[model samples]
Target: MEFRCIQDCSQCCIEREYYPSKKFGKIGVLILPEEKERIEQLAKINGLKISILPRIGISEEENSNPTKILAYQLMGIEPNGNTCPFLDTETSDKSPHGGFPCKIYNKRPLACMTYPLIESEPITLD
Candidate 1:
């Protein structure tokens, strides 16, 4: 299915309607060490808050293979879960085709760069 971005469809960035103009958005992306500095700095400039995923490498369940635990930074959550802080929640003239434009579109992470396109990809649930 060809996923087209519809106008006025803030479904992806309207998860937090209570506080429409939030600065610290919780993303579901797992950032890498190499991307930490860049993403953090940019996110800060855009008024977005970053959170560390798996904050710790050592957990109760994964005590055997500690390496499995990863420390990645994220901006938003599982697609519709959290509204991206970079997104212009205040839908107005700036919003295009009804969707909010990313404040850092050019520097968006790999997860967002390959959005919807991967939506159709097969999911392996082991």
Candidate 2:
């Protein structure tokens, strides 16, 4: 079997969901530690305001503040946490699939590149 994004569908980029639990609020596109600065720069160059939060971190001790961040998340623009800031919603231009194109598609995070393919009890596309 093969997987492909449905034409005219940008649900993956436009919709957000609470993960681990709602207490943590809606999760965003995962950005690796190495990609953090670059992602921030992309936002800045595009003149877009973005919110980034630590998604995973590591520390020497348990329950202690992380000394190093493993990954970060690029939050959405909506108050309810929908629509990635890099998604070109301002223009009528569309991706090859007919969905709204990502402003930073070429430089999108690895998570975005591997999206819909998640690891779980039984690995599957979301």
Candidate whose TM-score is highest:
2
Leading candidate by lDDT: 2
lDDT of 2 by residue, 8-117 (tens): 35666775567767766678888888898999999999999999999888999998999999888889887666788988887787767678877777788887776677
| TM of each candidate vs. truth | 0.55, 0.79
Task: Single out the weakest 10-residue window by summed lDDT for candidate 2.
Answer: 1-10
Q: Write the per-residue lDDT of candidate 1 for residues 2-56, one digit (tens) a residue.
A: 6654533555444332223344434355455666678879978877665545533
Q: How many residue pairs clash in each candidate?
A: 8, 0
Candidate 2 clash total? Answer: 0
> In model 1, what lDDT does residue 54 have?
53
Q: What C-alpha lDDT values do all the predictions have?
A: 0.56, 0.79
State residue 36's C-alpha deviation in candidate 1, in Å: 2.3
Reference-based lDDT, residue 76, model 2: 85
